[model samples]
Target: MEKDKIIKYGSLTLVAIFILSTLSLLFLNSNPSVNPNNSVLQGYVIGYAKISSYDKVVKVQNPTKELEKLLEDLSKNGTIVRSFNFENELVIELKDEKDVYRLNKLFNEYNSSIFADAIIDFENLTFFDDSGKQLSIPNQRKKQKITPLFDIAEPFKIKADAIVGEVSSKEPVVYLLSISLLENEKIQIALKPKNITLISYAISLKIPWDSRSYIYDLSSKLNQSNITNKVNLANYLFFNSTPSNTSLSQLASSNIPFISKITKSTISLNNIQTKKDEINNLLSLYNINVIFPDSSIEIENLDTKNINFIEGLVSNYSNLNISIQKENLVEVEFYQESEYGSTKYVLDEDKLKVRFKTALNPNDIKNISVQAEVVGNKIKDYKIQQEQ
Candidate 1:
């Protein structure tokens, strides 16, 4: 009986140890956030070329959108490794070469329809095989020669931005404000002008920020402008909230000026600040009252459940640097680069490090490029990167 009791106790101890080891392994292996390098298309690009052309390059639709739509029409089989503007054309890199063949077939089908405006110029489109040899598309259609609708002399330009988190919205969220507004007003909040149905609907929205435009972006601009005291931000920043509803619903409903929707022949990626912003912005447009992650409400305290959403929303864009502190704490830093300088913000969610550990993908946080930083949590320090 004594031997049996000792054996049973020892067996239970071993089982407990095994369970702890398994849990540790699972915790270590689980990825919390997206990896930055996952989006970087270094090699394995089968082909690259411009799919369409426009008379006015400035009016050229963002090729990313078109490419995404084209891929969707093909039943969403391909993963877009990378896309950027080269001269007048958009160069696309795909992981699978077979996907290119399927894409060509869909383009051929488009050529036969009235939607021929975006038909693939088969002769110009290039593809490759597994051996990295340029394989001529099989039974390729004759290159369609069509005159551009409008022609204007302007150098083709493009800016690359990174997408963080999953984007499920059908219509991308874009923030466009007049450049004059930034130059003139200390604080400007503008909305995108409604799409013009008469003209081409492929027009891309001109973005105001170099990297991204967050809803809290106004605060960063104000901090950089050195006019915080000059402008009455109290009226804009503080919003009335109900005891039951801890949100600034009245502020969100306030009329914001509609800036003209300016489009350039640029491919803006489906990059957004947060899923919360994307949802709330859509809700506001349709006169929907409810929202999540509203910034206007006062937070009496912080916890993992409450603060994780806040950190995730502000951590969008590319080239962020995250450091793990001594006690397994985390500090996430975001940077935005501009002609004038770079603005950086670092958020240390106080004793709530595990939230970031789960919210951020540890592999992609370090060694990433940060264009600017949001000083402290509110855009305090303004560092000017002098032009070389």
Candidate 2:
């Protein structure tokens, strides 16, 4: 009896150990913690190019081989570069006047680009100061004594810093020269009229200050000048601004006016496009097929539980059909049917068509599952014949 009791206890202990081990393995597989580097943000650019007027001409002098090399590197790295005449000065165009501020902020972080002997002739530009003063062409150049700003060691480093916390406010200032120049002569002289004033000065210094105040001041000045509802210096900065926290992938997605309003889907789509192009270039690098159907599929009545499943199916099969029923459960149909005489034949095309009564909210998604069927070309032909 004693020996039997010991043996029974041993057996129970072994069973418990086995069960615990199995549970541990399952938990680890389901809730795997991805490393930060391997996370989806790996290959994204944290900063984006700002849109600017095309009036500025960049000229480079008897370019040293080093300057040429730098230009080549900037171009390859996706920096916007436009040549002005035969001069070696390469004009860096920004998206908006606010972007001029961002460019200045970037300058504080990296000062090497400032030594290029570039002159920003805003002679044709008209702007206002913080005191509602009319800032016109051939305005006096004011030199402000400001602290020096540090340069970022690498682009990724700046991105990492932004992800960790808010950027600092104290930054350097630059000498700003306000002037009015002809738009036509802007390209000829390499000067453009940017809708900005104090903000332009702040940017030239590489300060990270928000342009809202500067923009407001400019608007007040422009309003006095009878410019209504105009996207002048102040309003443009307010509307087309992006947050400093924008990710690299988000920056590369669209040429939208503001970076702050960028969505995850847009970023994901851009990433998908890039990945697809890469796979096409090196087909042997990946095992999965990247081809997707040309037509759009609709899904309806998807709740949290089955939305994941539908997405997985679409991701795996490249085609799917979806529909929502009574706003409750999501009904997912994988196969398409066609009528033939007295019977209907099912097609093996791994495409899904989906229609949704309403748009799915991004936050409501829960668990996802996908079911796939492998069919050959011959199977597709047979199904077509049966339906016919």
Candidate 3:
């Protein structure tokens, strides 16, 4: 009887063990196990689908090729990881906790090896568990976000101050300058004229100074024929202004009074000014005539014949002094101190004579005078002065 009881108990124990093993296998099948190819996460698994599946999705910005490789590996392993693209961002969806944990582990391992420089950030990696809980990633690192050295508007202010501070000559009460980057990566400098009120507001908002007197002075200075003074005024207006985040091309269309010039980065404004001064000095020293055309010359008052005569005469000499004594007549006197001998030229089929004579002055300066009165395309009265 004792041997029979022992056998019965052993048989019952074996039967119980079989039932428990079968149930365990069924439970495992219901909650799929992920083979993450990792020894540390060997037993880690996902639970069966409940009311809620994925708590949250993972998002990545500016993803690199390594991220693609990681997803490809999981797809090759028969894991269903769905990915959706949204403009610059990539959204990844995992089936359950098992898949999330699997991907998370694989990503960390691959990221450490492939992205040692942290170029592709692991900080963008976010994971969640099956129970609708956020999972913290392991071996995660933080990256420093980059920012601009100065404000966008601050550069314009700084450049304006620097321009104003370098004024060696006359300083305008108010000036404005702007700089912008060109499409070819070149820098464009613009000198713009603004209202005195604008300058007033810029200098002191509390007490807006009436800079009308200064503006009048600047206007009068600009009206003069001196290129040196004009350039100085341009510098005053150009450097004492503001900068803009707007493009240079757009500002050009507004019809605002401004002088813009393109230059290289290696040359400073002071250097530019010095170079211009040196050029002017050289021209003066050599007595070289540089003719700059005037767009504002009025020819409305003169008759066609006089205009033609003046045009013909002026074209002969670049350094001629034009004197319009009357509407019908004009005189052009050009000093050719270096040239000798007499020369003749024809204006509209009218012959003109030139004479060279010594001046009565003590310097013994020779005068070459060309006096002519044409009568029906014929030379009548002509005088030429030569050195004594």
Candidate 4:
């Protein structure tokens, strides 16, 4: 009897273990955890949906409370939310990749359409998962893939016209016009004048101060052109602003007033002689002959010795009048004279101080030439006056 009871208890324990294992398997299938590849399904929430120009709303119904809540949250985030039950579809428009990924993950985890027996439609849109991996659905209405509006070989052109009123306000009244080529066809857009303000606002946000002035100037020109189209304004502001390789010839042809003011402040030299000497010294350092003298003074040749003679003279005579002349040869002239009536007998004791100017070149000096004659107590002045 004891052996039989032990056997019965062991059999019951084995049966209970089998039942628990089966329940675990069923639960795993019903609520599966995210896989490594499908990890993007986590931490994302629906943002919103937008209906394109080609899209039409047939009917909207939100049966699942979860989907309804998701749509409400997305609508608050500036997305156009649309739901249609007759077509058995839930369409959500997203602002950016972040929102698109969020909604995609929610749909994957909830198996949204599978549970609701509805279809998920992404109209005129594309999506990427959290890892930047593309998510493609099978057996859905084919979305028309829009090639970028502008071609790779062309860039968007911008043009505007405006009239400046005599009012105190700085705002420029504008008239805007724009045209774009799509699928090798030209499309003209019309924009109202008020939209010009929006374009200005966007320009101020994106462009620097200097560039912003150009855009503002364009706005003023637009206001003056008498443009009555609002669609043109939107196209020029948003579509043209994006990166493109489209030809902007038409946009460039529009005339706009752009003014650039460059103010330059002038600096005047207080002492002309000092400035001339300084400039000569700089020139001499480059092995260039800039100074030629009217008279002769025996000094070390600068070309042979590479010695700076003008720099030494300026250092010695701080108030020396240094003049530069360009004739058959460059000349540096200097002179100083004293007036006197008293006479001394000794020629050497005459106490005559002769001031002479010297000319030197980086090349060989063949002979010295003096153009002025010196009288008693006076040296001839051959100073060449330079225009300031």
Please, what are the lDDT tens digits per residue for candidate 3 over residues 1-388?
1210111010000000000000111111111253322212111111111111122234444556887776777667666445545335554545543454455455555542111000011112222323434433332211211111111121211110001111111221222211111111111111122232432222121101122223323323333545233322322111111112331111110112221221111101111222344433533453433222131122222335644654554445334333322221112232211111111212432322121222233122221123333333223434331221
Q: State the lDDT of candidate 1 residue by residue for 56-107, as single tens digits.
A: 1111123455554764553345354444443344434444444444444544
* Predicted candidate 2 versus true structure: per-residue lDDT over 1-388, tens digit per residue: 1210111010000000000000010100111354433432211110111112222212222445665575566557655444332223334432232333444344444333322112222112222333434433122221111111122221211111111111122321222112221112222121113322332321121112223233223323322433331222122111111212221111111122211121111001112332444433432343322332222222233344544544454356342222222222222233355322222334454543321221334333221222122132111321110000
lDDT of 4 by residue, 296-346 (tens): 211223332333444454446555443322212223322132111121111
lDDT of 2 at 94: 28
Instruction: Report RMSD (Å) for each prediction in the order shown.
Output: 29.5, 29.5, 34.0, 34.1
- Listed in order, each prediction's TM-score against the native is 0.16, 0.19, 0.15, 0.19
Give the poorly placed runs of model 4, Cα more than 4 Å off: 1-65, 73-97, 109-388
Residue 296 local lDDT, model 3: 17
| lDDT for 43 (candidate 4) | 12
Score residue 306 of candidate 1 by CA lDDT: 31
Error of 4 at 55 (Å): 20
Off by over 4 Å in 3: 1-53, 110-388
Residue 20, model 4: Cα distance from true site in angstroms: 70
lDDT at residue 61 of model 3 (Cα atoms):
44
